[model samples]
Target: MAKANKKDDNVVARNRKANHDFFIEDTIECGLVLKGTEIKSVRAGHINLKDGFARIERGEVWLYNVHISPFKEGNIFNHDPLRPRKLLLKRREINKLEKNVQQAGHTLVPLKVYIKHGVAKVLIGIARGKKQHDKRQAIKEKTMKREAQRAMKI
Candidate 1:
């Protein structure tokens, strides 16, 4: 088992809408390499994974649209907020994601970002885009689940 960091236990950013908007097929954990300033920014909980997605380019996995804000006290050496960052994954994992994403409407969405053992990691999931009606169905199902839980409590 991995030892959890005591202080940064909570998530920095999560695309909750991703769950509602897409059907998640698989999940993969990947390490992100960042500059010192970028790490500082992430450690401070200044990140947005809302519109972030992962892509395979040139046989490598890259995360796009993931925003890590500049350090509060950073100088000229601060990293770019929207720079495309490399994702560390096994070659086998990269091959799998590339295959699945080639299909129509299938994508890799970034679900959450958090600090694990003082390292920044992104939790990305393979997802298929949902239609408008499907989204409504998901909402209806969620509402029923919430109602059932409330009734159980009562």
Candidate 2:
């Protein structure tokens, strides 16, 4: 079977702080458990991934703090904005994430949420917290790179 590419057209929300506050080590894709209007709201690009995180609870992966806006046209079936969504992942992946998270300053953070193949998916990354000096160095390095690119053009 061939897998179809479903690139997102409109981005609902992005966790800009994630890149700045944490050094992302690895990322994994997980399916999201959504309700009626939730899928529609997400497809419309009305969701937020900032301050969202994934954690294993009772042997299951759950996402917390992410917001999916209610459907404009939805009435009684509108999904809650702050509801915790279950993540679909294999047992091995769950164990690996949990183990890695418990080591040092590692954590699981969701980077984005979008619809793919008529289903919702969350992109979660295993990250290590960055120190104050690390963030400053990152900004300096980024600025230097931009300067180099500009100089090369002229």
lDDT winner among the candidates? 1
Task: Spell out the clash pairs found in candidate 1.
Answer: none
Look at candidate 2 and tell me the lDDT of residue 63: 95
What tens-digit string does per-residue lDDT give for candidate 1 at 58-108? 999999998899998998989889999999999999998999899999999
lDDT of 2 at 48: 82
Give model 1's TM-score versus the native structure: 0.89
Please identify model 1 stretches exceeding 4 Å from their true place: 1-10
Q: After superposition, how far is residue 78 of candidate 2 from its true place, in Å?
A: 1.2
Q: Write the per-residue lDDT of candidate 2 for residues 15-115, one digit (tens) a residue.
A: 88999999999999899998888888888888888889988898899999998889999998887799999999999999899888889889999987766
**Residue 36 shift from truth in candidate 1, angstroms:** 2.4
Ten residues in sequence with the least summed lDDT for candidate 2 = 5-14
lDDT of 1 at 45: 82
Assess every candidate by TM-score: 0.89, 0.90
